[model samples]
Every structure is written in C-alpha cells, then in structure tokens.
Target: MRVLVVDDERGLTRALQRGLGAEGFAVDVVHDGDSALEAATSVDYDAIVLDIMLPRRNGYDVLAALRDREVWTPVLMLSAKDGEHDVADGLDLGADDYLTKPFSFVVLVARLRALVRRPTGARPAVLTAGDVTLDPSTREVTRAGSPVDLTARETSLLEYLMRHADRAVGKVELRDHVWDAPGEDLNVVEVYVGYLRRKLGRDAVVTVRGTGYRMGG
Candidate 1:
C-alpha cells in the first residue's frame, strides 16, 4: 500500500519514511500543510499520517479541505496535544483516527493497518493474481501456496501490479508510485520487472511492447 505522511518535523518524517518503507509501504512525505494538501490531492494514498501543527496550514484545515473536495482517503491525525478536545476536533473534521506524539512506532503501524483495513475502498490486506498471493500486513508472497522470497522493492512492485490486475501499467506510473526518489531512470522499472519475471515465472508478467506490463498474459 501507499501512504502520504505530512509533518513539519524533519526528523519524524525521515524516520517514518524509512520505517514505513521497510514495512513494504510506498510512502510519500511532505513537510508543511500546503505541500501536504497538494500531495494528498494529486495522489491516491491508501492512508495519510497528518500532523496537527504545521507551517502553512494546520491539519484541521487540510482535513476539512480534503473532505470538502470529497476526498475520502483515510487520515490518522497526529498531534503533541493528547487532550480529548483536540482528538475530538480532528475526528469531527473527518480524520479517521488520531495518534498523539511520542507514540510507539509499533502502535503507530498497528493503527495504520487498522485504518487501511477499515473498508474505505482501499486494497485488501491480501492481494492475489493467478496463483500468486500477497499479504500486505505480513509482507508475505505465496505462489501456489508456496512461499516466495522478494526484496522490498519487488514486493511493492508486485503489489501495485496485482492491485491493478485488470489493465496494463506503464513504466512511468510504476516509477512514480513504486519509487521514492526523484530523477530515477525509467530503466529501473524494466530491471525490476525482469527480476519479478524470473522469480514468479516468465509468463506471470507480460510486456505490452509499446505500453508497459500486465499481471498475466
């Protein structure tokens, strides 16, 4: 799954980007509320981790704007203030869940999983295509009920493909969603697709010549 993390704390955002990336999530991060709003609006994130105290706009205004625009992405509001009123205000403004600062990383991940699984038209805990099955929560992939070892990037790529099983996915889309860095070469997508094909069987992912790739032939 993909997540958008909005926080002014550079340390916190970097930590989350690393931790969540290691957990097999494609994470995009922005510091201020304006960037947060722009990113959230442009991308279809499975979940959002929003900080209340922001530079340009606060989390409340961000959440209200998203709701006003009819964006239903699940949001987990984070704040240093653990007061009941603060929590209630975030929820009232349409945040799906709330977490106070200085919280446990384990607890934060658990809360995120809970929010993602709440059936907001988000992808399921497990994704399947043909004989291959992938569980996002456990970061496990199985083919014909047998375990498949994959690098973190491979897991993210396969998940993206399986989620859009119906049509072809272009290299640009894959690069944008699966990769975090800017100025990455599009050839990386081809390289990883080759890796996946070798592991999952060549017939598993078919190249569409001029287009990109599809899950099955």
Candidate 2:
C-alpha cells in the first residue's frame, strides 16, 4: 500500500522511507505541513504518518483540512506531546491514530498494518434536508441538482449540522465539535454558520436565541 510520511526530521524520515519501503509500502516523504497538504490532496495515499508541530501548518491543521475535504485516508500522528488532552485533541480533530514521539518503529509498523487492514470509519449514507444533499464519502454538497462550492471549514460545519437534523445544535457545540474552541467565546461559530447560510440559502441553518443552531428550519 502507499503511505505518506510527514515530518520535519529529515534523518528520521529517510530512515522510515527506507525501512517502510522495504516493508512493501510505497512511501513518500514531506517535510512540512504545507507540503503534506499538497501531497495528500493530490495523491491517493493508503496511509499517512504525520508529525505535529510542523512548520507552516501544524499536524492538526493538516488533519482538519483533510477531514474537511473528506479525504479519510487513515492517519497516524506523531508528536512529542503525550499529555491526555493533547491526544484527545488529535483524536477529536479527526486523526485515525496517534503515536507519541520516541515511539518504536516496530510499534509504528504494526499500527500501520492494523490501520490498513481495517475498513475506514463507517460513514452514513448521503444526508438530505429539503433541497440540500450531502455525501460524506465524496464531500459533495448539492443544493437541488446544482453543485455548491464551500470551503473546508464550511463543509465540516454543514456536515455536523446535517447529521443532527432533528434538533437544535448550540453554537458552543458547533465550536467544540467543528472549531475545537477551548474558550467560551463562540463568535467563530456564528461567522461560519453565516458562511454556510450564504452557500446553502439564508434559511439553511436555524439559530436558537436561547439554545443553539439547528439544521434547517
């Protein structure tokens, strides 16, 4: 299978490239988040080994962007941060798996084998509300029959809303899930919700003054 190794450590990456290459993986290496993002979006890699704290864009940003674009290739994040919340943040941001720095190459290989062996995270069938439809697998959203262009963040937000179409989803919830905000300030949610409305029509997402926002009216 193909793999992308993203880390700024040239020496380690070279070693991994040789070792993983010997293990029968077609491995490509990138040194920074910007390069990682470009490679990931263009190539259909079977798996990815991403390091956090990358220059340009960090691992979290790259992972979020990939998920937002609906590219669900399994990811194994490498980071020096071993704190519980750090790991939780990676997982919450949509990483398939994570490895702390100084991890054993053996363990890494084993984890990659397991990840490639398993089926990807199960995605729900295409979601529909009123005239809008969303296909999670393709990250495709359509209003009526025509296509709509949405940024990565916009798509992620819309997916969350559509998944819970039955009730109101509070702005805080949206921030926590979509934006990964740590503080109480949630104006970003409102801004993105407005962005979604622009693409999905003004009435796409309903705001609950006292509660939160919900899918459709």
What's the TM-score of each model vs. the native?
0.89, 0.56
| Model 1 Cα lDDT, one tens digit per residue, 1-217 | 6789999999999999999888767788899999999999988787899999999999999999999999999999999999999999999999999999899998888888677766465557788899989877777898888898999889888988987889999998888777775357999999999999889889889898899998984
Candidate 2 on 174-217: residue-level lDDT in tens? 66545422363788888988998988888888887899988774
lDDT of 1 at 132: 89
Worst 10-residue stretch by lDDT in candidate 2? 175-184
In model 2, the number of clashes is 0
Output the number of the TM-score-best candidate: 1
